[model samples]
Target chain A: MQVAKTVKDINNWVRHTKESGRSIGLVPTMGFLHEGHLSLVEAAKAENDLVVMSIFVNPAQFGPNEDFERYPRDFERDSQLAEKAGVDMIFAPSAEEMYPRESPITMGAGTLANVLCGKSRPGHFDGVLKVVTKLFHLVQPDSAYFGQKDAQQLAIVESLVQDFNFPLRICRVDTVREQDGLAKSSRNVYLSETERAEAPKLYQALQQGAAAAREGKDPVPEMARLIQSETSGTIDYIELLSYPDLNEAPDGQAILALAVQFQKARLIDNIIFTLKEN
Target chain B: MQVAKTVKDINNWVRHTKESGRSIGLVPTMGFLHEGHLSLVEAAKAENDLVVMSIFVNPAQFGPNEDFERYPRDFERDSQLAEKAGVDMIFAPSAEEMYPRESPITMGAGTLANVLCGKSRPGHFDGVLKVVTKLFHLVQPDSAYFGQKDAQQLAIVESLVQDFNFPLRICRVDTVREQDGLAKSSRNVYLSETERAEAPKLYQALQQGAAAAREGKDPVPEMARLIQSETSGTIDYIELLSYPDLNEAPDGQAILALAVQFQKARLIDNIIFTLKEN
Candidate 1:
């Protein structure tokens, strides 16, 4: 697999690919590649003529008090994993390379970014949208992939793509999880032995809520209560938000979202499934 | 010479052209087409295989107290002129078509937009950026053409394109002028016969500023005084901003921008030139 370390190289490859009329697929990640990232690559490889996987730990997305200094990084491991997953090219740009200067223009999410992770991490979605826009421009991909683990992110990005009239199609792959129920995340490495034991509970709690909702139960309050009862850490919010929009779903057709401050690291996860009637 | 009043039809045409690998050029105008707009269309036609000229008298760009109700539009005349200018298509979306739903995304100009036209007309640049962004998405053009008559607009759009990575090449055409040296603008109609005779004074003041700067004079304060002395209306601001970034030029490569208000209408214009060793 070819490895592109700069925006110029990626654009060169993209130009050649587009001239050949091949559809390029992109999967953006923060670089501690896991089974979840692999799933996105697999999806890209299946549907596209060329698959590009980018690894950049974006600084704009992390707050000043956040764990930006020690988020995570292992380029050798990430490149190897991406190659193994049939990625055509690996774009691994440094933080400086990814963002050369301060972004003067910020993409506004409006109401879409006012809840869930947006509430806990202010200016986070703006950062996310900024980096993603840069990536999309550099790659000029026909399609881009993201995991549903970041349910709100998926929704916001989809909205950005649509609202901006971006020419690419966005695909949301299912959230890849561990053998147990916990969702895969690079930040999962931040959990301590004791906190790691409790990490699964976060996803487990989401599962309980998802199950209750899927069984046609009005589980917004129920899910909130169950998550609050099971988790001893500082809970930011444990509410059921409508799929995609993040509004309070009265009929419970919403995703169960969770965030808890375990010791020092802030952990978040969600489960999305619609309520169905017999 | 076909006129498409609907955005959908224009989209269909533009999409077909894109799918067929034809490069597109866009010239967005607030109708009342004159030599200035057609000059932009001419530039687009020279550059791309397909040109889509959109005539939209955008309401959002005008403040409530401003002349949005009478901002000057003549779609039939515009389409005829655009066709003669060799434009392949014209997108004449109504206010309803351009903003069917209320726009959630709004743009801000930070410090640059806080002076001159933006200072007198609040939210003007924001509306300009927002509608321009929407036009960029819908047209998906390889290049966009804008006249340098609106020097601040040209500069801000350059920054916007760079920040958003919109894959657009902004081609700035030279300012087109009437026989009297007055810069061509749709709002030039709002001037009375006396005000119209004095319209050339705006350009004359700019010429004076450019000449003085070229002769090693600090043109900022002098140009402001010149513009104010020449116009008999309420002078809003007569400031000099640098090219590209629109900041104050340290070495006299400044743009002379002015805004003057009569009884019913407020008018704005600008000119840019470089300083030299005398």
Candidate 2:
């Protein structure tokens, strides 16, 4: 696979691909490619004539107190994995290559970013939107792939595309998970042995919540109780938000999402499903 | 020339142009066609195989106290003018068509938008950036045109394109002028005969200030004094700022800008020039 390290190279490559009448797909990720990121790449490969995967640990998306300096990165492993997944090109730009100066224009996520992780980590989604916007412009993909593990991010990005009239389709792949039901995340590597064992409870609670909501029970509180009782960690939030909008869910559709902090890692998961009317 | 009033139609037209291996240029205007806007169209026509001019009197760029409702618009006139200027298409989307729902995301103009027009009109540049961004996405032009009459707006947009890595070049056309050296603006029509006679003083002051700066004098205060003394209008501001950044001008390059209010019209003008070292 070809590897592009500069904006000029990637744009030139994309221009050539378009001139050849071939559709291009983009999969943007923070490198440390897991099964989840590979799943997005696989989706892109299936749909497009050329698949470009970008792996940049964006500093704009992290707060001062957050793990920006230590966010996981392994370009060699990522490039190999992306190639194995049939990616045509790997765009691995350094932070300096991506941002030569401070970004004088920033995007505000509006009401959608005011809840969930947005409340916990302020200015996070603004940064997310900023970098994603840059990636979309640089890649000029016909379609872009994103995992549903970051459901809020997915929703905000979808809103951004629609609101800004971005000329690309958002292909949302299902969340990749471990055999034990815990969602696959690069941060999962930071979990201790005992925390790893307790991590699956986060997803379990979401599933149980979905089940209760399907059975006509109020799933919000039940999900919170289940996580609090089952996990040996601090419960950050247990919210039943409306799918895609993140407001309080209406009767027939809801997303049961939660965040739990272990000794070494913080894990989050969600189950979005439709409910039958009572 | 083709007229596209919906996003889908304009995008389809743009797609067909690209498919035929032709480049597209865009000139975005707020209708009420004048020689100034057509000049931008002429520039676009000269540069690209196809040119798309959009006449959207964007409400987003107007403050509540500003003249949004009274913004001049004449699509028929604009289309005829655009055709005469050799434009390939005119995309004239209605406000409802442009914004079917409330925008879920808003752009912040950062520090460059915090001065001059931005200070006098809060949330104005945000709106300008928003609609400009929407137009860029919808048209996907190879190069977009803007008149330098709105110097601050042009600078903010240039910064937006760079900071977001927008996949297009910005072509800045010189400010079009009347025979009397007054800059052509849609609002120029609002001036009474006496006010029209005095309107040229704004440009004269800018020219005088530039001449003084060329002779190694700081032009900011002198420009303010000339406008206040010569104009039969209330002087709002006369400032010299750095080109493209709007900070304090350095030794060689500076932008002399002014805003003055007539009995029936609010007017703004600027001259950006470089001085030879004394």
Candidate 3:
């Protein structure tokens, strides 16, 4: 596996792959890899001739009050994980390299971007769109992989791809989880030992909500209340919305999302269930 | 030339070309081809193996009060013109087809977009980005062409490709001017006889500004005075800023932009110059 830290190196490497007729795949992540990110890499490797994983702990996606600086990153560990997962290249760019200038153009906001994560961290997705877009340009991938762990981001990216005609396919991998059911995330490192113990409750709440909806319950509102009841961890929001369109999850299409603050570290996770037809 | 009005048709066409190892070039425009557009097609033909033109008068780029309804379009004439210019495919999607479901994810705004057309027409750049991105996605061109007549737009699209890693080279064809010196635009159809008679002065003033800059005259004030003094039509703005990153162009790397009111129609144009260093 090749590791490139500079944008030029990554661009040249990806272009070489393209010219050589290799179908490139990209898995963009704010690094500190876990099973979730590895799952995406594995999915990319299965579908693409080459897979490029970007390890960027993007600061823009975090608000001034949020933990941008404290975000965990271990390049050596991530590189090993990616290589083991069959990634062909790892692009780790400095903040300056990824965003040399402020974005002059703006992607129109995703509707759900305003609902959960967007509600708590405004301009977060704007930052996400910008960096993801820059990476898409760099990788020139035939397909890009993203984890369903970040369901809203998955939807927004799908929207970006479909709307823009990005000349690439976006493949979504299912959420990867811990043995106890906590969805894997780089931010999971922030959980204190006690908060870590309570983290599984967030996933449990999501599952209960999904189960309720699965067993003939009205998913949206009931799921919301169950999430709100399960954790007193300053609920950012718990929504049940469409997994992909993020529109009102037509009785047949919806996912349960949860965000809770545990010991000052905000942990977000969601579980998508196939709902019965309206 | 084959014409594909649907995204699926164009996507298939581009895929077929790719199967044979040919590169596709895209020139996106709202139908009503003029010399300016033809020059873009000429640049694409000269550079790429296959050329695709998208005729979409994107409504998203127009302000509420702008002329979307009256935007001049003649599909038959445009198809003939593209064929004459050696265009291999014309992708003319209807507004409904182009915008299915009001585009959930849109391309973002970059530097040039916020200033000129962006200020005059709120959400104009958003619309440009939406359609341009969609065209890029569907056409999968190796290179895309735009006229320097819309210098700021050319800059924005270039930024999008660079920022998004769209896997295409961007070529800026020089502005195509008429014998009387007006920059070619499909909106030229909006001009009545008197307006047509007055339009040439807009470009004349722009030239005067360029000449002043090239001759080492203080470009800012001279450009302002020249543009304000020479035109009978209502003027919106005229100013020259040193080109970005190439800051303080002693030899004048600059962009000259203007908007003029001719009757009820507002027309805009710009020219970017790279002065040979003294």
The candidate that achieves the highest DockQ relative to the unseen native structure? 2
In order of appearance, the predictions have TM-scores of 0.93, 0.98, 0.89
- Residue-level lDDT of model 3, residues A1-278, one tens digit each, is 99999988987897677667778889998778888888888888888888889888888788998888887878888898888888888899898887776655676566757776888888888778877777787787888888888888888888877766677888879888899998887777777776787678788778777887778675556655654565546677777777677766446667778778777678889887788775
Where model 3 places Cα greater than 4 Å from the true spot, the runs are: A214-232, A248-250, B108-111, B213-232, B244-251, B274-278
**List of clashing residue pairs for candidate 1:** none
Candidate 2 wrong stretches, greater than 4 Å: B276-278
The true-versus-predicted C-alpha distance at residue B273 of model 2, in Å, is 0.8
The residue-by-residue lDDT of candidate 3 on B1-278, one tens digit each, is: 99898878877887778767888888988878898888888889888989998888888888888888888879989888899999999888887777777665656564565565566777787778777877777887889988877766777787777766566788888888889988888778778887888788788777877777677665556655655576556767665655532123334477767888777677787767866567
lDDT of 2 by residue, B1-278 (tens): 89999988988998888899999999999999889998998899899989999889898889888899988777777778888889888899999989988967889888887766777888899999999999999999999999999999999999989978899999999999999999999999899998898889889888988898888788778777776787789877787777888887555677888888898789999999987766
Model 2 scores a C-alpha lDDT of 0.87
* Model 1 lDDT tens row, B52-105: 888888888888887888778777787778888888888888887777676444
Model 2, residue pairs in steric clash: none
Under CAPRI classification, how is model 2 graded? high
- As for DockQ, the candidate ahead, 1 or 3, is 3
In model 1, where do residues sit more than 4 Å from their true spots? A211-232, A249-252, A275-278, B1-8, B215-230
| lDDT for position A242 in model 2 | 78
CA lDDT, every prediction? 0.80, 0.87, 0.77
Instruction: Write the number of the candidate with greater TM-score, choosing between 1 and 2.
Output: 2
